[model samples]
Target: MFNGLSFEKLLLVGVIAVFLLGPDKLPSYAAKLGRLVRTLRDYANGAKVRMKEEMGPEFDDVDWKKLDPRQYDPRRIIREALLDDAPAAAVPVIKPVSRPEPAYLSRQKDAVPSQAHDDSATPFDSEST
Candidate 1:
């Protein structure tokens, strides 16, 4: 957007900033700025790498040769996911059976003696003799 700005205009901006911050502080300030920029660039590159890893090989399938920045809305890519006629994808629909109660259930439930069921007398007992 600032392509029309002349070299003189950039020189003026640099002069003003140097005057405001002073010459001695500029080198140290520039070193810190360079480090900050490197950190941010590294962070962005790491994120891009991680996204490529997570998305698999298809992540690099960008058509850089034909990419149009103006039409790059993410929502446009998923526009058909919510369609009314979206296909009913095939799946194994397990039919649950209403199982009848086992005939021995009542007998098993009443068989455990109260004295033999004391929690302190088992191998996990806290009150072992």
Candidate 2:
């Protein structure tokens, strides 16, 4: 059965097909279409059988509708994960231990004169401009 097509729509399509193909070619085309449908059905069934063989008894237990990719929604999944009943374990908060300043920094601070108290003019390079 067509997913949404009514009998009227199908009849219209059939009428158009008959007009397009004419009486001479319609039977052969119809036979080809039937064969194609049969082949597709066989392929689907073969796949299902192969899956059953590979999966063993678990194949029957699987919820096919639930496993369908069309049901997948990232938003719904994220929301469900967020709304899960069990609370997550609290992470331990660690206060960082105070460390002594590095020797190089202390030495640099002592070596560099404070700019607020310094009266020297900054050197400018005229040629580099």
Candidate 3:
């Protein structure tokens, strides 16, 4: 049931645990860990039971997989968003319109000759004015 952890990683963890705990304490520690896991599992089941009791019959109808954060991936979300069952001809394509230059910039262009326009004059510099 370990989703992300591979067999090699789990084996490495077990080997490290054996080396750190030693042969004498390993069995006792393993027993304690199993008990701890059992206790946590019991707590989770109790919480689920309590939630079902509080939420009534509606909790049974709830979509747990859809609500789960791990169920969503970037690829899945993008795929869902881009999905269109209709024909391509039915979809309208929008063309961008070219906007005219602002009044000040237009006036500046008309007042200044193309050849006389100084390329070295920086727009933002206080010395330019």
What are the lDDT figures for the candidates, one per model?
0.76, 0.84, 0.83
Report the lDDT tens digits of candidate 3 across residue range 1-129.
679899999999999999999999999999999999999999999999999999999999999988988877999788876896566666677898776666546666677585455766655433344
TM-score attained by model 3: 0.51
Model 3 segments more than 4 A misplaced = 71-129
Tens digits of per-residue lDDT, candidate 2, 17-123, equal 99999999999999999999999999999999999999999999999998889889999999999999897899999999786776545665677476333436564
Over 4 Å off, model 2: 82-85, 99-129
State, as a TM-score between 0 and 1, how close model 2 is to the true structure.
0.68
TM-score of each: 0.45, 0.68, 0.51
Candidate 1 residue-pair clash tally: 0
Single out the weakest 10-residue window by summed lDDT for candidate 2.
Answer: 115-124
Taking the candidates one at a time, how many backbone clashes does each contain?
A: 0, 0, 0
Clashing pairs in 1: none
